[model samples]
Target: MRVVLQRVSKASVTVDGAVVGEIGAGLLLLVGIGQEDEEKDLAWMADKVAGLRIFEDGDGKMNLSVEDVGGAVLSVSQFTLYGDCRKGRRPNFMAAARPEQASDLYDRFNALLRAKGLTVATGTFGAMMEVSLVNDGPVTLILDSPA
Candidate 1:
C-alpha cells in the first residue's frame, strides 16, 4: 500500500464537470493499493496517517495531528503511485492491484480513516477525477507499507 498525503487549506474532486467530494482545512490523500495489499496493510497505513504530527501546534511547531485540529480528509484512489518508471520510457503498472482488489482496499482504507473520528470525503473509485487543492505550507509526504 502507498499513500501520498498533502496538507491543504481546502480540496475538492470533480468528475464529468461535476464536483464530487470536497473538504476544507484538511489533508488531500491520494491512495494506492499494491497487488499484495490486505486488511493489515490498510490498518497500518490508516493508523500512521491518523497519528502523523504534521499540523502546527500552539508554538507554531509542527506538533499537532490532523485529529487534533479536527480537520477533514479527501481520499482519492490513485493506482499510479505504484507505477514503475525505473526502466522504460512508459511507466509500468504491473505492481498495482487489479481494480476489484484496489477498489475494495480503497473503500476499506477510507472506512478506517472514518473510524478514527475524522471527516472523510472520497472521490469515486476508478473514475477519472480532477482534484484541486490549496496546499497548506505545501506540506506533503509519501507513505508506503513494508513489502
Candidate 2:
C-alpha cells in the first residue's frame, strides 16, 4: 500500500464534471494499493496518517495532527502510484493491484480513517477523477506499508 499525503487548506474531487468528494482544511490523500497489500498494511497506514503531526501549532511549530484541528480528509484511489517508469518511456502498472482487490482495500482504508473520528470524504473507486486543492505549506509526504 502507498499513500501520497498532501496537507491542504481545502480539497475536492470531480467525476464526470460533478464534484464527488470535498473537504476543508485537511489531508488530500491519494492512495494506491499494491498487489501484495493486505489487512496489516491498511491498519498501519491508517494509524500513521491519523497521528502524523504535520500541521502547525499556534507558535508556528509543526506540532498538531489533523485530528487536533478538527479537519477533514478527501481520499482518492490512484493506482498510478505503482506505475513503474524506470525503464521505458511509458509507465508500467504491473505492480498495481487488480481492480477487485484494489477497490476492496481502498474502501477499507477509508473506513479505517473514519473510525479514527475524523471527517472523511472519498472519490469513487476506479473513477477518472479530477482533484483540486490548496496545499497548506505545500506539505506532501509519501507512505509505503512495510514489506
TM per candidate comes to 0.98, 0.98
Candidate-wise lDDT, in order: 0.95, 0.95
User: Model 1: runs farther than 4 Å from truth?
Assistant: none
Candidate 2 lDDT by residue in tens digits, 1-147:
999999999999999999999999999999999999999999999999999999999999999999898899999999999999999799999999999999999999999999999899999898889999999998999999997
lDDT of 1 by residue, 34-110 (tens): 99999999999999888999999999999998999999999999999999999979999999999999999999999
Superposed model 2: Cα runs more than 4 Å off: none
What's model 2's TM-score? Answer: 0.98
**Positional deviation of 36 in candidate 2, in angstroms?**
0.4
Please list all clashing residue pairs in model 2, or write none if there are none. Answer: none
